[model samples]
Target: MTERAIVAGVPVDTRHWIGGRRVASPGTFTTTSPVTRTALAEMSRGTALEAEAAVAAARAAFPGWAATGRAERARILHAVADGVEQRLEDLAAVETHDNGALLRSHRRGVMPRVAHNFRFFAEWLLTLGRDDFATRGHTNHISWDPAGPCVLITPWNAPLMLASWKIAPALAAGNTVVLKPAEWSPLTASLLADIAAGAGVPPGVLNVVQGYGEDLGRALVSHPGVRRISFTGSVPTARRIAAAAAPNLTPLSLELGGKSPLLVFADADLGLAADLAVEQYDNAGQVCLAATRLLVEESVAGEFTRLFTERAERLRPGDPREPGTDLGPVVDARQLERIDGFVRRALAAGARAVIGGGPGTGDSGTGESGLHYRPTLLTDVAQESEIVQEEVFGPVLTLQTFTTEEEAVGLANGTRFGLAATLVTGDRARAARVAAQLVAGTVWVNCFFVRDLRAPFGGSRDSGTGREGGGWSFDFHCDVKNTVTAPKGWRDHG
Candidate 1:
């Protein structure tokens, strides 16, 4: 059964996109808006059968999609980017409504970034050429080919943007995809399916399935037909997917959790460091690469903490639909409760709540719901405390101080995660030196949250297994083969 309804002023089609068509299942689940706690849409609750069907669709379409020439694929991807631009307003609204991201930020940041992901890889692939080398009597040639049908499982935190990160590269590499979007935020993924098909993507080249991870996710990962699986989520879930994919010997790429740290040196710009610290609360601190721990040089710790706490205090949590809202609610009431639990445990273990400490009373004058947490700053938190070491995916930050550069690096790498880090320092040489020692995959000097799609992105240790973005993703989605030949009367070049 299917129903027509308007959610957050946008019309919604409560059906799954499979085989380039709208698929309505007998079973469905209601998706509620995190901002209003109201039903956004009734999405098809996908099952093992649907998962298999979507995979079959991709498998069926793989030969044709993989046979597409590079220029033709680039043209189609560019068209998809243009289509995303046209739907920016509706996409942003749907994302904010379903995922609780601020409307203005979604419009200003997320939408453009999604479009950029498509255009970047689309153009980048054009520059890629096969390798051919000839030396005297010997010749060698190397080529890249698609890795067959792949499954992309994206998290809820930046739904469409993260999906684009995986989807654009896979398609650019000529791999058909079965996208399993988080049930909490499936609206934009569905819309993306429509946009892609309209952009001249062949039927079954892209499909979207919606449901809980246990049912739909397990089915998709373990499906024998899926050649590659790229996922972004928690470590525990990554482990589960890894186990499932193990039986099939499927290639996997995972970008998992992070307890990333931010280091501020004595000679750093304290004002800018403090501003970046406050910006950690952006997206309610639900980002995977969020610098949740602050390691400041002892010499400048006091001033940095004061400025940081002041900025955290000024953050106003409000409805995501409002233009001036600084912080929106966490994804839902469950996340709100989990955030509260982290704060409570931190307080019990001697961490001081220096600013806007506990859960939101929801009585704040901004018409915000109860699912809000005022930006929280924790001081005197133990290095071993759960709140400090674990992934607290909320608007809460923990603070600690280190006296020397060595100690700062040590403290930063103490956690199992090596996803990302930021170092703020005035000296260029010192910045380079410390960044080299830091265990994180991507280190930023004098800045926070700076990203280039052309750069390699992923983590070390438990953070993730492989990298994404730029040529790394291209390499991941495709298989490399080298062919060697020798002239009629040739000897070994070696």
Candidate 2:
């Protein structure tokens, strides 16, 4: 199991990693590459039995792991980071091959962040502060205790990176983990288990189970032994998980879907604004935090639209493995059809497609037909239209004009989602004013997608529940306890 077998010319090791060993499932499922529209690998299709085993293993390992010294945990986490860095190129390649995102992005942006997730949390654990104070003649000491076994369910869009975001914090807080990566992309998650073992993580400390959400995911979240659950996926799935875990009353953190907006004012730099708008097309618009809804001031709408359309059309779509490819195919044919359906319905509803409006062929000619969708920009859509109100989750952008500042804010906040938003303006007062009013968990003024690992990251309303990053992450993974003691001489006096 140490070496991967070649499937369709891609190296793949498909097995469940449980109790620090590779466990074979009763059945297997094939995962397809969006770029080639062909079978990429045969993955272990986990059942409830596998899920139960993973949970048991995590539970068995929890006590020793939780009791491990902070310094030793930090050292082990650092070693994990070192292991990730050593396989940076290989991991990036496998991620791109499995998920169809641009290889350059995985190599330069995503993979580096994966390593940093481990390293940053490792350092944060040693320096993490707890409150200690005296009040009412009593001294109180606050400490965070590990919350037992944790189950982390990650999405397919950025499998390894996002998984680490949850994994690092859980491990840093001294909790054992059972990771269930999205079925569409499980190769990297499997590889990560190997990486963890190589870095000296003890058996049963970290386990990975690959399968659909209905069976494996349900079992993992509903299991009574699971003390904490963190899931990143669609709203419907989150609701289901919540219902499943309700009986057990297991603490849950859910990061769901978003239809984020980007606001552009007349005073904003047109060039920078346009650049930010086009960034929504990155990852083929699979990003949960992408600003798919563009709200522009009427005075600058025409100018901004022209700039955005020009840059978007110039983007190169090709094989993700190519260094020059700016955009890759959507995850699969099903996803491609979903994107097309959204655009078609919008068009029929009288919205105009200013640029690309349908399926596109890859420039590399290596992929199957209908795998690529052109970067699309829509205009003249009503405020209440489905295109504007829903999360397309594709390379599609909808533009709406706002007559006044109040109207702009209304349009931006109209949707049920409140994941993230971007405000483009030169006036510092207006930027601060509008940013404060935006109903999103994360708001960027004069920038987009700029992330600081220590900053809080999550959504509001339908976007998600709870937050993660820095102390917030620790808050979710650990139980904060307050120890109170009476004044030293009070008992003597009594």
Candidate 3:
């Protein structure tokens, strides 16, 4: 409602920000709006050259940044948080317009959290200190050192927020970084570069390169100067990056895809379960940790299904800019089609649709238009079916039944991905048992998607490679060095 935030339909700046300046590339690509299926802006396309330049800048700045005082680093981070808060509305508007995320969520959920990521890491860094312990022969000192130049690659689903997750910690730990945001949603990232510079982040300590992953991503991963890489996206892409980075032997922290499960027991509050089940369709179910698989106790399966389907039907799909829209369009046509294909394949393989099962009309008065898919719920879906096993990454939920606690645990852990899981049970013993049995990095007992900044967040098996949060994130961005020295006039006792 401010003039700067009047961004219902606008094309934002699309140039790269490197070394505290705007850098343009020869080739460009048009980013299309998922809400209108129209060209939003032509972004400057970066290639190996631009990526190399960005890396060189970061590498050059690494030594100075690493030696910066902890207090100064924390101060800069605080300033960055302050800058983001100042531009919160504008950034939220740009994200909703570029990524098709519901504005309501961006305003209330995403943007505010972006500032939190910076503030949390900044405050945490202040608590850190060198550790020293005495041994028989010598005293050992352990300290964390910066990982040097690092590349942060974030996906488009929650662009600014996810980028903040990587950028905040990397900088807090005294590493210079080159951020390559998904081309589909690079506007706010561009804005962030300016904000960081304005907040007194030294030139080259933080840079942004806007381009497709294939060109820029490969170059960034293999660059010798990039000491570390933190990426969040699909599993297949993570695998590719892992292979590419193997020759360099660079450290990588990948938070890849997920086929997370949500189990509802007979003792759970059925209404709450149903409500949370429908809420999984947030962001049109494009979240990496969305509850795609729903396991229910056989005794209450039918009742839960009925309530969930009713809630799913009432999900108000509309344009993301609309005030009351519950669901927005998918990121693009390809993703929307992919979601539909999954539903179709499941149905062909004998899954039953309890409610919506196809593309939505975008007429729910939520203001949605392009690339809109209905909130779908399917039952009778086999555990082995692709829809149930794979990461759908859309607003589609598959239902299955389990009679026993052991069966539910088996079903929940069946998927290769193990990013997250949720268990709804009133029985304290059952909650603890199932939570421990579920093979996920994070498990919510009788709740869904509640996260603490200090808690570790990542997956097991095929989901990801490392944990990141609070100290976990600090560890990833830093190298632990142990120093040992003999005390004056001391000798080995043993």
Candidate 4:
């Protein structure tokens, strides 16, 4: 299949990619661009029929894919990487149009990471090792066997990149996949299925089904043939998926919601700290790992708040495709309303909006009205308020002050989310101490959102379950088996 150049005006092909072919569905749902508020594509709304077909296809292909040598698998994955590199710009445009993330971000970082996900996992698989030891005159060889079929449900925010995070590792570990992308941003996943096929990934090795989460997602997760599931979304949906997979006892890797905190110490570089704090507004704060809760030392609260609010007010929310756009609209109108509701409630409760407190108009001349929410900063908020505890998942930041290190740690760990946190401090000992006390799975010191990809990445508490990176990814996607054998001398004697 020839790849199409996806742009704002061009219509996209959003069909189900099953068994390396474009499969049609009985109904279709329109996907609108958050930039223009116009229809960009009609996604095939998958049903039980499509779900059953996808699972059956994956089951039939799993044995052959698992039996294939690691070297050959790596080769095909490298080819997939090559395909991604060749179409990076096109993929970036599609994703920007579908999800309202900045096109520059996709081209510069996100798209390259998508290709790297495949290449990195491929190389990691080659150097992967298992346990081999002898005990009590007997030898035990531990091997990793690929789980059968995997169901990957990715979120609309950073759609293709997050999906690749799971798909690359799952495929490298030798599992067949049935990917059900978020209905709002299904175009890039379909494009990826084509890329995989053209790169010689076998039929049914990577299948994509598009539709709503309740119907299509439920069907995929609850399917009897699915052996593993990896989902990136909200906590409530993760719970629902957990309940659905309970019957089959299928293993799940869920990366859910987060109300992560950014701790700024008085001794830290206020300039750099303010820069990092404003970065929470990146992708319009749609990122799950963003440090949305700003906890500042009481002594520096005024200075930090001024710096942060100034930087935030300068952020430009416009058409994602424009090169000058600093931020883009929230995914849709529903998300816009949700973000506004939180800000409105906080204001009614006496929380002060330092800069933005409501929805943004189309005054930027690039995005539609009601879709863009201004980068917001709130101060004088109670520590236990909804704006502080809940995962707003928007360009909204709440500032609070703490007097002591213990109070800072307590406030940072107060939320139910343990996905990630950021600490900005000049003191090495203090940085280490605060980071150790942080309950998050990943903690950033003196920076924000710098990922190694080889370290474990996930959350705790209500944030998520399981981790994925390097060997951790394989651990979730494969079953470790131990085979025991008698010693050579003992076998001879027998």
By the TM-score metric, which is better: model 1 or model 3? 1
Q: Which stretches of candidate 3 lie above 4 Å from their native place?
A: 1-11, 362-366, 489-494
For candidate 3, what's the RMSD?
3.3
Give a tens-digit lDDT track for model 2, residues 144-232.
89999999999999999999999999999999999999999888898788889999999999999999988899999999999999999
**Candidate 3 C-alpha lDDT tens digits along 1-494:** 11121235443456787877878888988777787777667788899999999998898899999999999999999999999999888888888878899988888889999999999999999986666888996889878899899999999999999999999999999999999999888778888987899999999999999787788889999888788999999888888899889998999999999999999999999998998788799999999888888999999998998898788777778888888778889998888889999999989989888878998875645466757888888998888889988888889998899999999999999989899998888899999888988999999877788888999999999999899998989888999788989768767699
TM-score versus the correct structure, for each prediction: 0.97, 0.97, 0.96, 0.97
Whole-model lDDT for model 2 versus the true structure? 0.90
lDDT (Cα, tens digit) per residue for candidate 1, span 68-147 = 99999999999999999999999999999898999999899999999999999999899866668987857888777999
Write down the worst ten-residue block by lDDT for model 3: 1-10
Candidate models: Cα lDDT each:
0.90, 0.90, 0.88, 0.90
> What's the C-alpha lDDT at position 161 in model 2?
98
Backbone clashes, each candidate: 0, 0, 5, 0
Q: What clash pairs does model 3 have? A: 318-366, 318-367, 318-368, 319-367, 319-368
Roughly what TM-score does model 4 have, to 2 decimal places? 0.97
| Candidate 2: 10-residue stretch with minimal lDDT | 1-10
Q: Give residue 157's error in model 2 in angstroms.
A: 0.5
